[model samples]
Every structure is written in C-alpha cells, then in structure tokens.
Target: MKKRGSGILCHITSLPSPFGIGDFGAGAYEFADFLSEAKQSYWQILPLNPTNKRYFDSPFSSLSSCAGNTALISPQLLAAEGLLTQMEVEDHPHFPERRVDYPAVSRFKRQLFQRAHIRFQKGGVPEDYARFCRGNSMWLEDHALFTAISDHLGNLPLAEWPQELSNRSSEKVQLLREELWDEVEREKFLQYLFFKQWHLLKNYCNGKGIRIIGEFPMFMNYDAVDIWANPELFKVDEQKKPYLLAGSPADAFSAEGQLFNCAVYDWDGLRRNGFNWWIRRFHYLFRQYDFVRIDHFQGLTSCWEVPVGEQNGLRGNWQKVPTQEFFNTMLQHYPLFPVIAEDLGTIGADVRETMARYAIPGMKVILFGFQKEARERSYLPHLHPLNSVAYTGTHDTDTVTGWYQGAGDEERLELYRYLGRRVENGVNWELIRLALMSVAHTAVIQMQDVLGAGEESRMNRPGKAEGNWEWRIPTADLGEVASRLSEMTACYGRAQD
Candidate 1:
C-alpha cells in the first residue's frame, strides 16, 4: 500500500466460528468490525484457493487456483439465503475450538452442501447462477469436470487414469459431461455460492474503508485442473506427468534444498501463447482482491528447476524467464498493478531491479531483524525502506513470542540493545510497536502475535507436512486487543481516521 497504514494477517479459516472451521458468516463480519475498531486500514490473508487433505490442507497447495474452497462455504449463510433451515445449520457435531478438524469439518459441511444443492435445484436455478457459470466458464467448466471425473474414478491421479480420459479426448469429454451432468452441475453450484459469499464479505470490508490483501500462489498443483487442461504450458512428459518441478536450491537454510512437488511453468510456452493464461489469472485475482501479493516473487526473475525423481532440490538449476517482456505485457493489459512482492530468501540484484522497475513493495519481517552481526540486520525496523511492508512475522515463521523464546542468547541481547531495553515479557508487543513505528508505508501483525500467543498458536511450520495450517483463534480473544492496537496505531500516525 502506498498510504501509511496497518493491518492484521489472519486467514478466513482462522476466524472464530461454531461450524468447526471459519467461513463467510457472522464471525467474518465480526472480524471486520474488530478491524474498524482497531483503526486498521487493511486485512491481509492467505490464499483463498481450495486445499486438499493430500497436501495437509495448506492453502499454498490448492486443488484449483481459480476455484474457491467449497469447505469454506458457510452453512449459516445458506440458512439466511433459504437454502437450508436453521436447525440444519446448527446440526454439526462438536468440533475442537483451537484447531481445525479438517476431516470432521469437511464431512459435516459436505452433507450440508448436498442438502443445500438439492434445495437450490428444487427452487429452480437462478439466472445469477447461470450467469456466474457463463462468466467463469474458462476455468470453471474444466475444473468441475475434472473434479467429477476424479471422484468417479475413486480419486485416482490423472496420470494413472485411462488414456482417453487423461488425454481429454473431445469425444470422451462430451460423453462424460452428459453422463455426469448432475455431478458437474453440483460442482458449479458450489463455486457460485463461494463467489457470492466471498464478494459480499469483501464489499462489507470495503464499506468500512478496509482493503483486502490476498496471496497469488506461485506454482500450480500437478493434479490441478489448470495443469490438466493446459498440459502444454507446464514441464510434463508425454503421458502428462511432471518431468520438472518447482522448488528452492540448497542454501543457508537446508543442505538438501526443498522440493515443492508442484508443476513448473514452461516460460517459453507461456511467452509463445502471449501469456494469455497468466493474463486471465491476473484478471480473476484483481476482481476478487484489492491488492494481490505475488508469492515467491523471485521465481518471476528465475526459478530453480528440479528434475522429477529427485529427493531434494540440491541438484536443481536456475532457469531464467523473460521478466522484462512478461511485465511489459502485463502492464499493457492492466496499467495499474497493485501488487506486493514476497522477496524473502536469497534475493538477487536482478529481482531487486525488477521490483524497483515496477514500484512493487517488497516485504520486511521484524522477527528476522535480530542478527548476530549488524551488517546482516537489514530487517530491523529502523532500516526498513518507506516503500516496504513490515511484519512481526509471516505464516511460515513462528509467532513473535515463540521466536523470542527460541532465539539464541546473542540475538536476544542484540534485540534488547536495539531497543535500549531488556524486555522480559510481551516481546510480541515490543515487535508490534517497532513495526508500526517503522518508516515503512504498511505494517501487518499476525493475529497470533496480536494476542501475544506462543509457539502453540503458530500457523504453519515449513518442512512439517501435517498438523500445519490448523491453528484457529478463540472468539473471545478477538475484541480484547482492539483498544491497545488502536492506541498504538494512532500514536504511530498509521490509524484510519
């Protein structure tokens, strides 16, 4: 954001809700009200794409980049819309409050969704639903068909499916569409409900003068509809299997590097097609969000290409992309690109140059500021550039308190010296204060940090596949921090007037 402002980094699923997991319901509205009370100007969230159990429900590994997660559909909203009865909405089994029970929640929500679909059909499909399908048919139709076929084939991977279906022969696809008309329609109906609810919440936030910041995932899942429908755009083999994957090369963090297991984009193929696929993706995202954060922004300059069958990213080579030409095309399509770059690890000069050329704000995390050496402490609040977006920590890092507790003695001493005070407790607030007071135009605090929560509340732990992306906040804790946050915001000249 160009304007000086502050916001909270809390995902929609992390909001307090009675329906096992959060959705676009009363809880979401209440959160927006809390932001207003806190004098915040923005609300940053993770990707809204659909997550899969196979991927440990991480938002980054989604079923479809274009489709909304059906599990996030609110039964409460359904009742209000006459799609279900109040009793039906409240019929869910008791779910844990502090963490999401994905399986339990999915089963419960799926049942309600089925009933709601039946009701929707009985009431006759509205023109709005038909119009939504028509508007998003570019991706919606293929996604729905892919999902229906996946379920019909007992969740078999597309590569293992019969040659006719995997290749998506026109004759086979037509027959499958006719045979599975009901299932296909059901999938489309779910998506219609998702957008209708999502936009309503977004409008409510906008009315309160708060803008939404959404993440644009860098890679696409191999099993996703986009890859299946447009195989030529990715590095897949003759049988439509991924031969090269996306990941990071071995660096200071890991000796073995990291294997992302996602499909790598063939930049040449994209360039040949005039980047039409990317243009469509950008158009869809801007329509849904006020600002889109380009995740893994370094990949735009060059990506570490890991060959398939490799256990890790050690042997991957850096493949360069036509960064200048790509952005030129994007600018021609959308003159005003409101984007933030996730320029975190090992950012090269080329990446920095591209970001500067586009005037895209890069990120700075306060948690990463406490280094043993002063030269390495560029993330410190005092060093943050005015164009940057500063944070206490991101979803990938531990909560503020957790980081403080786990940091080494030398780092803690450096932090104390930096502040000219040895703070024993409320370290999270100390960092929050520093972030807000920084020269950075925008500052964002994680909900966990705002609550002074510890390691147990950390959102995601990279490298650990399971038990991540399950943290949820208690309903009682939301309003408690507004007064404190408001005073700090006003003191730092970042409050919304």
Candidate 2:
C-alpha cells in the first residue's frame, strides 16, 4: 500500500466454478494466478460472511461477522481430503455459468457438506478442527449454537423465537444444546473447513505477491449472531427488539434514502466497554486480510438514526458518536491496523478531518467524476490524490460500459471532455486507463469493467431488493483479461514485479 499498485474488485461468488457458486477451490487459485500474471499487487473482495437469502443476500448483512461463508467451502478440497468421493465432485446439475443461482447453489452444496460432515464425524475429528474450535471459541461457540438453533427452529430470527430462546436463558440454551449437539458440531465443522481452505487460498495468493483487501461493513445485521449474543451492545429494548434502526439520510442516490434493517449501536455501552467487541472483530479480520476496507466509514463520525417502524430513511435524524475515542482505543490496542475508508456519499468535514488525521486512504470513483458543472472535479482522475484508491466503478455502481451506454448526451459530452477521447474506442478500457494513470496510489477495476460488460452484468443497484450479488465471470475470459490488464499495469508503472 505504500507504493502505487492496482487490483481487481471481484467477489469469490463471481468466480467461475462447476458448482453453482464460486468457492475456495480451483477457481480461487486460478484467479490468484491470474492476478500474478496480470502483475496486480492486490485482490479486493467483498465481505465473505455467510449470506441469508431469506432476509437479504447482501454480504454486508451476514449471519455472523466472524464466520466464513460455508457456501464458499470447496467440495474439490473436501474430495482431496478424502471426505468426498470424486463422483460426488464431478456429478452436479448443469448450473448457469454466467450468474450465480444462490438458492440452487445453497441447496446443492448443503447436501454435499452434510455428507462430508457425516464422513468426518464417523472417521474422527481432526486435530486441526479441535484446535480451530479452541482458538475461535470466543465467538465460535455462540455462533455455532445460534446457527444450530436457528436451523432447528426453521431459520427464525432470534427476536421472534420463544422468549426463553430469544433471551438466551441458560437453562433453555443448555437444553437446546443437548438436543441439537450434532447440528452445533456440524456448524463448527463447517467453519473449520472454511478457514482451513481460506488460509490455503490466501497463502497461495501471498506467495504470488498478491495481497487480499477484504471489506467490512460498518453495521451488523439485527438477526446476526453478534447482536443475538450481545443484545446489550445494540439499541435493543429489554425484549431485544430494536428501538432505533440504522439507515442513511436522503441523498442524490435515493430521495427516500436507504433503509438498512440493522440495529443502531449502543455507542455509550461500546465506549464503557472500551470497544472490545470491535477490537476483537478487527483482530480477527486483520489476521485474514492484508488490508481492510471499512464500509460506510461516515457512520463512525455521525449516522442517520431512523426510528424502528420507519419505512424509509427520509425521516431519520442525525446521531453523533464518539468517533475519535473509538478509533483511539482501537489504535491503542492495534496501532498499525491498515484500513481503507469507503468515504463515498455525503461526507462531512469531521469525517474528512478524522481520515486525514489518521492518514487512512479514501476512495475515489471515476464514474462520479463527470458532471455538467466543471466545479465537481474531486472525483476526476487528474484531481485525485495519491493517498486515495481510485476506481473505474465500484460493485455498487454500473459497469463502465453500462454507465457510458446509459449516460445522457450531456454526461457523455462531459466524459469525453474529461478523458479527451470519444466512446468509440471502448469506454470501459478508456476509463480503466484513466484509473490506472491517476495519481492515486492504488486503482481498482471491477471484473465487469475489465470484460467490458453491460448493464445486465451490474453487481448491485443500491435500493434494489432482489437480483443482486449474482454476477459471475466467464471462465474462458480470464487469460485474455489478465494479459490486457498486465499490459496496462506495465504501461502505467503499477506493475507488481
């Protein structure tokens, strides 16, 4: 991060695989090799938390912040370990190669994992599994029990469960643990496999001089094991229901603002406890990633606090938190924590000042640079600072090709004026070049932009409820994309080696 470098923003789910969704299998290794071939110094991925398709499939809203997506556990790796048969690995439904069918993938993988778990249990638990459980017990025990109970109760949110269960009464917990002990062990076993496979993949990338940049959401989901196990740390009443929810104030992206059904943090409680939970979170994440991108960093300074029953974020009020003290406590414990601030959207002076004081890098997106007015130039490549990470477009925005195609005449003209080129040469490549050539120390290009994908390939639309986080890359395109990206890297002096 000290030197100028480049990376690709592609979530593991977007990788091509025989299984419906990508995993820490051959596809992940191939992508690491691809990054090495492209001379890329980093590989950025969204959060790897287990997704809840029933609520929202967004990785930001996860079941457990410390848990890895067991859906991402590679069956190939399991087969290699002799836990699964080769026939089981090869035999699969004809899944869509271009996009992930999350539900279909989950159903298929769940059955396979169950078989593997059965085999592991019958044979014997490995020493590594025992060690992993002991090491991560702080959160693992609660998460495993929570997951087992949730599954046993048909996946109901903790708050909606029986009062004894929702409140985590020790007597009820012990009773359920005894009844669901096998399922609890199964959950723990899955986590062990996930981390084991992830470390192997991460080590492979590091060996090739490619570092991983992992994303972390600012807020935890209400239904997540974190809040379920530690209700007192959130804005929840005695019944564990949220009194104040989390969301953003109305902005250009959404006139009604965005309604994120997460519970607002009990800032006072966190401060009184010296932010131990967050410290432990970062401690775990730092071990897994070289650098972390803090999502919605503006919330650290101040956040829009929407009431519990609000339908939209338009009626939310601003609530200030002890941002400086929180970070100070974090730094006191882990001073060298490398972080990238996702400082997009409505930024206040306090947010910018805090980031500057800490020397943390902020994000700059090239897609937002072009405006009819010349005054809006901060996002323009030439105006971008070397301390920031520039991007062609983020996972939340449309692909460069898609944006250009959908842009109005005025926007197109403005883009042309900024880049000093017409769209005929391929707007995606043009913007990719702009990002690489920027003074920003790091540049990240979405996998979709590298392939010149259109609107259909967009990863997310901020306010949309469905049909998001499903984009996948074609396996055949990796080699060519790597070559082109390597050329750009060399030309722009962003090459790793």
Candidate 3:
C-alpha cells in the first residue's frame, strides 16, 4: 500500500526571516505551521552544509558535508539562547531581507556564533554537550578540529596548510590537538548551538507531522574538512591531490557533459571497516530526518570518473560502481532506512534495478513532464509513474509559471494536449491538478510555484554559477499558499490527519 502525501520543497535557508538568509528559528516554525495548515507532510531541503565563497553551482557541492551550514544557524535563536541580545542581533549588518549575501551573512553570523562559543566556554560544557561530543566523536571531533584550525590559520585549502597539519601526520596532529584545544572547543560549541536550535526546529515540525527531507550528497568537496580529515576514504594521493575525480559524459543538458571533480571514494579503504563511515553518516542523518534523499542516485550505480587534470566536464568516462554490494552491506546493518532516489538526468537500467530492489522510491519531476512537444518533454503530470516522489519542479528548475511563460507556443500547446485543457490560463494550478491526480504516492512542489512565481524564484540553474539559492518567499505568501495548496491536497486525497 502507498502512503500518499503533499509536500513543500523549500530549503530551510530560503525560509523568510528578517536576517539576511533564513535560519532554523521562528521562520522554521512558521513554515511548519503553514505546511500543517496546507495539509502537507514533507519538508524538503537541500544539503545543509557550509558553502564555499564561489557561491558555487550547488549546495550539493559543499564543505563539511556532515555539518549544518553555520550560515543557516539562526542569530535570533542565539538571542533566545542568551548568546546575544535582541538589539545586538538587530544591529547585524543591515542585510537585504530578500536575498542571501553570503559574505555579509557569514561575517555577521560568525561573530554571533563566536559569542555563543564564548558563552559556552564560560558557562562550561553541559553534560548533554559532553554526551553529544562522545556520541559523535568519530566525525564531530575531526570536523570541529578542522573548523578551528581552518579559522585560526585563515581558511586556506587543506593542501596548502603547513605540511605537519595539511598531511595530518600523527605526531603533528597530536601536537596541534594539544596546542589548539581551546579553538577546537569553541568550534564544537558553535556546532552545539546549531544542533540545539536545529533539533528544536525539527521537533516542532515533527509535532505537526512534517518530516524533513534532509539531503545526502554523493561526494564531499575538496576544501571540506572531512575530505582532508579522512584522506584515506577518497581517491586522493599522499599530497591530498585527487587520484580520480568524478564527472559525467555529454548529455542533453550539457553537450560537453557534466564534470563533477569532487573526490571519489576508495572502496578498499571503506571496506576495511565494513563501510563503518557510511553507516555513521546515515545514523547521524537518520536522527535528524525521517527520510533521506540521496542526491545523484546514478553515481552509486556506475560513476563517471574524470582524470584530475581534465579541462572541462566533457571528458569524463563512466566506470562501474559497487553500490549493489555497498547497499546490501549497509541495509543489512540498518534496515528501516527510508530513502528517496533522485533518478533524474541520464539514468541506466542498473540504477532503477538497484532502487527497485531496495524498495526505495525514485523521483518524478512535474516541470519536466509538461511541454507542447508531445513526444519531447516527459515531465508532464499525466505521464507520472507510481513508486516515485513527484515535484512540480526541483530546486534546479525554474518554477512552474517560469517554465510556462518561457516555453514556446508549441511547448505550451503540447502541455495543453497532455493535460487535456488549455495551457494558456492558470498553468500553475493546472499543473498542480495534474500532479495531485497522478499515480505518484508522494508529490512535492517548490514554494515558488505555490505562489505562481516565475524565473527569479528559481533555486539553481544547472550550469550557472552565482545568484543561486538566494531567493526568499515573503512571509505573507505563507498563509495564502498554505490554504490554496490545502484545497488541492483535499481534492487529491493527500490530506494528512
């Protein structure tokens, strides 16, 4: 039997707030309240990790894959935690309320989190804090220590740091650990506040029956503390240079193909501990979210490995992956792990077979479904297949309204035939109707589409670099979007208790 639901796909950082970007504070609660009123069951977000300054192509490619983006750590919540006063937080550099100025927000939030760290140091650690440290010692210690060293020495790439630290010599590591104990403590404290605030927000959503859709990216970024800290796990040489980075061959989207230079894993290194690292990752995520969405599910089936010196993503080659055995071993240890497979882009039969074997549902995108070229676009709602998570559009695509207006006459006409109705008027609502009426058990729509927003509300453009993950929906849009979507939820039989 299928468990049906209607969900909102807005990353937590996109939640409306007075601060530069949304944080896991009141904005989270308000969003959850809105979702409950709208009868939505899932709250999907992008990978929650510290981002590099490039304002890079995606949140999927992020530093600190396991840690929450310190940028999203709510300053308002800090005030509530007594780390800052309301006025101090309000005085935060007058940031544009609508978009995230990453640099500006990073400086201001760092200072605020520093204050929280100071307070934690002065107050001394709590028992729960110690327990959290002990419980998460494996990743937490390395991440916290990496953050401290990175901050103190300036955020240089791990490769460029002093040889002792960069290569992580046992003697050097021990010496540095003793020398920089205080800094490590401070970083850990910052993470504690983030975890504290985030869990509180997650609990609120859970109380309202909203399960978070936390993301799990396929690989870790080079600048990440994790990659440097666990050098053996990736295909990196003794100098920390990548042995074989990952990317995809030329496809419909990019004629040159997709070059994902992120570090690929060394299965032998992982196999030694019986994939204990992977198990630990899922365990931490399972505690934070009810369901985990594995980004680039295809990577696990068969990865495309690019030589380190490749000029563009175009020259990568596809290599067979051992994901079948990996999943088999992983599930044997942790069974009831609910996951959603992102089977977008060029996928192969092995990918579907793997997902089907595990009973993990794949994703169906609605924006990709609609088009005037009847034979061209397969994203139209009428073509949706069951056993998948459906979306009006993903974080990468333009909102429904944007897709409609930007599409040519034939594209719109094709949509008309697909929906058996005029494509010209109320395109957003019509698409929503088709999504709800489909065989998909779970349907998700970006908050942008809920308000009939256009291109500017788009989350990320696949190849474009900047001005992504910046759009914010006005808080006032919450009530109307919730109610309007609730009506659709009821009509679609996805209304939750």
lDDT of 3 by residue, 377-460 (tens): 445555566778878778877788988888987777777777666756678887777777777888988888888888878888
Off by over 4 Å in 2: 371-375
Model 1: lDDT of residue 45: 93
Better lDDT candidate (1, 3):
1
Using lDDT, give the best candidate's number: 1
Ranking by lDDT: 1, 2, 3
Per-residue error at 264 for model 3, in Å? 0.9
| Segments of candidate 1 deviating more than 4 angstroms | 252-255, 371-375
Candidate 1 lDDT over 390-412, as tens digits, reads 98989988898987888889888
The CA lDDT of each predicted structure is 0.88, 0.88, 0.78
How well does candidate 3 score on lDDT at residue 199? 90
lDDT of 3 at 491: 89
lDDT (Cα, tens digit) per residue for candidate 2, span 1-497: 87999999999999988998888999999889999999999999999988897755889876687998899999999999989999998988889999899888888888899999999999987788888989999999999999999899899876788888887756998899999998999999999999999999999999999999999778878888888788878998766778787888776556678878788889998888889989999988999999999998988888888998888888888889898898898899889979999988777998999999999999998888863332257988888988999998888888988877777898999887876767665789998999999999999999899999999999888888799999999868578878889999999999997
Q: Candidate 1 at residue 63, lDDT?
A: 67
Candidate 3 residue-wise lDDT at 436 = 77
